[model samples]
Target: MTESILVVEDEVRIARLLQIELECEGYRVSIAGSGHQGLELYQEQQPDLLLLDVMLPGFSGIELLRRIRAGDADTPVLLLTAKSSVEDKVSGLDLGANDYITKPFQIEELLARVRAALRLASGRKKVETDSWLRADDLELNEATREVMRAGRTIELTPREFDLLVFLLKNKRQVLNREQIMTAVWGYDYYGDTNVVDVYIRYVRKKLTQDNQEELIHTVRGIGYVLKDSL
Candidate 1:
């Protein structure tokens, strides 16, 4: 099946260029001129991947990403912006963006990143066919991408889900930031290792909600470990 891609860019020329390039690569592509239109098309099309620009009319791309993640965290979102500061990158990634590319980027690099995101999504779907991972009272059904803790459902973003699974698979073993990043986000990821700490916090927050016991323990000066009894 040809993967569908949605380009949510406020710039007309850039949007058209992206659409043409993606279509030439055998992907079904759609373009939106503003954040509102992007959101509407996103719901209607349910594209396999989203190419979102940060600056936009009405709501910003970051805001759109937040809203998308609130309800659907499985889709891959790649952010495009002129802001190349470390803070900007961290902000987007923290909001559940799968990847970030600044303006004045090479088309080759953009295509490569897009391919990487889609490939990761494909790999995840393949792994989700018939597998279950568990740690303590937390159970994750990869097939359904559903997580349950103490008989209650727990929602998580794709990255968070991947991180938890990695930790669960290595239960009782301390995994450093580099190890976790490679296993969960792939070796090609070129972001700050602190992203690992951020995601760990996210997982811990969701898992320990409502005064539940914590299964993830931070190892001082090392990394983290998941154990039934910490």
Candidate 2:
């Protein structure tokens, strides 16, 4: 079946361009000019993925993301904005956005990101068939995309979950930032490597919320490692 994508961008030109490009890439695409329309289309179409632009007239992209995450946490959301600050990226990621792309972005890069998000989403569905990755007391169920530490559920964003899963799959091995980024974010990712650190911090913060012993360790001047013991 062809995957459906919902694009919520206020700019008419950008929206049409994206819709045309995505459709040309064999995806079923829907465009919304406002956040209100986006939300309605979201509820009605339930697209496989969402490409959302910030700075909408009625409601901002961040607000729409928050609302979407409140009810649907599994669908991948990619945020498009001109705000390239670390703060904005962190805020969007923290609010459960699957990926972020700065405006004036190359069409090739945008298409790559959209493909990566959809690929990840597809893998998530396939993994729901009893696949589990474990490290120490932390357990990640690929099938359900659930994480648990010491038998307690731990919430994680899609990126965070992917990062943790990558670590677990390569447990006890030091993974450099480049490797982690390429593995988790896709090979065509053009973002800075600091994104790896940011996501690692997010996963660590959530996993250690109950004062649990850290399973992920910084290798210092090298990379990071996840092991049963330091």
Candidate 3:
């Protein structure tokens, strides 16, 4: 069966264009004009992939992605943003978007990104795993993207989870800010320190709460390191 793709875009022209292009590529395509409608279709159709616009009328794409990831992690979401800022890209990727594309992008690049995301989601692409990493109560299952703390499930945004997993994998190894950015955000990052800072703050706030000893330690003027003793 052909993989089904759902395009959630508020702009009529973009939606129509994507429908035509994707259908021509011989894949099933569906379109929703708003987050509400997109989510409704998602529950009903359960499309194999989602093409979500960052800006929406009723609900923001980031909010929608959060909701979707809360329920399902297997579904691949490609976030399309008009803003090309590094912060925006980092935010989208942090929120669980498999791929991020700024608007006015080349059609070929968009399609390639889509295919790569799908391939990764579908297990067609190989991903290196770090076996397992443990830091105090937090345990990271790198291969499965599962995180647990003291036997309690710790819900994390995709980027937050990735950041934590990466840190844990290289536990005790001080990873500089640039290294973290390059590893988590890929080489596309254009020297955005705020992206790293913002995400690290988010990770620290969300993952370590209720007086839990923080596992992610920040070395002054350096970067971050994950240590169980911290």
Point to the candidate with the largest TM-score.
1
- Model 1 has an lDDT value of 0.91
Go through the candidates in order and give each one's C-alpha lDDT: 0.91, 0.90, 0.84
| lDDT by residue for model 1 (1-230), tens | 99999999989999999998999999999999888999999999999999999888979898899999999888999999785566767778999999999897888899999999999998887778557788878999877889999899999999898898889889999988899999998989999999999999999999998998889999988899999954
Q: Could you tell which candidate, 2 or 3, scores higher by lDDT?
A: 2
- Candidate numbers sorted by lDDT from highest down: 1, 2, 3
lDDT of 2 at 165: 89
Worst 10 residues of 3 by lDDT: 123-132
**After aligning candidate 3 to the native by TM-score, how far in Å is the CA of 163 from where it should be?**
31
How well does each candidate superpose onto the true structure, as a TM-score?
0.59, 0.57, 0.54
Candidate 3 per-residue lDDT over residues 153-193, each given as its tens digit: 87889989888878877889999998999889998878667
User: What is the C-alpha lDDT profile of model 2 across 1-230, one tens digit per residue?
Assistant: 99999999999999999999999999999999898999999999999999998778788888999999999888999999785567767888999999999988899999999899989988877877558888878889887788898999999888888899899999999999999999999999999999999999998899887778989999999899999854
lDDT score for residue 129 of model 1? 57
How high a TM-score does candidate 3 get? 0.54
Model 3 Cα RMSD, 1 decimal: 13.3
